[model samples]
Target: MNETKEMRLAAINNLIKFISERGRRFFYRERNRMTGEPQTAYLKLKNNRIYFVDAYTSKEVYAYSGYPHDGFSHGGTLWALVCDFSIFVRTGKSSNGKHGYGGLYSGDWGHGDEIQEEIINYAKEIGYLE
Candidate 1:
C-alpha cells in the first residue's frame, strides 16, 4: 500500500476547536507501568475520520480513516508526520494510539511540533485540562 493522506491547515485547525469544545469531558489516559505516571489523551471524529492526540510525544495529532464497524478500531494515523504525508493502516486486532502505531509507521519521517503544540493548547483553552 502506497497511499498518502493530507489534512488542510484550516481543517486541522477546525478539528482542534471541535475537540476542545465538545471533547474536553472525555479526556482519558493510562499509567505507563515503567513510569507510573498517567499520560493525557483525547480523540475526536468527523466525516468518517478520527483525530487522535498523544501528548506523550511532541504533543502531535494524527488523522486516520474511521473504522469499518468500530469507530475506535485500531490503527495509526501518522500520515501527517512525514514531509511526504505518506500514511498507511494495517489490519490488526487492537485499538487506540497505544497499539504500537496501530498499523501506521513512516520510519521516523517528521513531525510538526508547532501543530502538535497548538492542539494541546487548544484542548486546554477549552478547559480540557481544567
Candidate 2:
C-alpha cells in the first residue's frame, strides 16, 4: 500500500521511540547453526499493528501490515515479524500476497542498508526521529 511521506515518517519515528523505551527487551533472535550467530531483529507486536524495524539493517525499512485483528484480542498485542520488515502481521495474518503485493518469497527484506536511511529520512520529515 502507498503512504504519504508524512505518514510513513511518523510511523518510523513512533517505532524508534517504542524501541528506545523498550530497549533490547523487545528483540528476539534465533541462532544460526552454521555461523553460530544470532539472526537479526525479531518481529513482535505491541499495539494493534506489527512494527517492522531492524537494528542490523542500516537502511530504513517500512512498516508492513500484520495479521488482521484488533487490539482487544491477543492481549492487546498483535505484531509478528515473519521475515524482516517485509512480511509482518499487524492484526491478522499479513501474507505478502494477501495485502495485494506478491513479495511472498519467504525471505527477509530488511537486509538492505537503505532500511536505516529510509527510516531516518522519514522520521526527520515527520519530526519523529529527531
State residue 53's C-alpha deviation in candidate 2, in Å: 3.5
Give the Cα-based TM-score of candidate 2 against the true structure.
0.25
Clashes of each: 0, 21
List the candidate 1 regions with Cα displacement exceeding 4 Å.
Answer: 1-110
Candidate 1: worst-modelled 10 consecutive residues by lDDT: 83-92
lDDT of 1 by residue, 1-130 (tens): 1221233323333433443334231222345333556643444344544455442331334454333122322223333221111122222111223423422122232335554455555534432221
TM agreement with the true structure for every prediction: 0.23, 0.25
Worst 10 residues of 2 by lDDT: 70-79
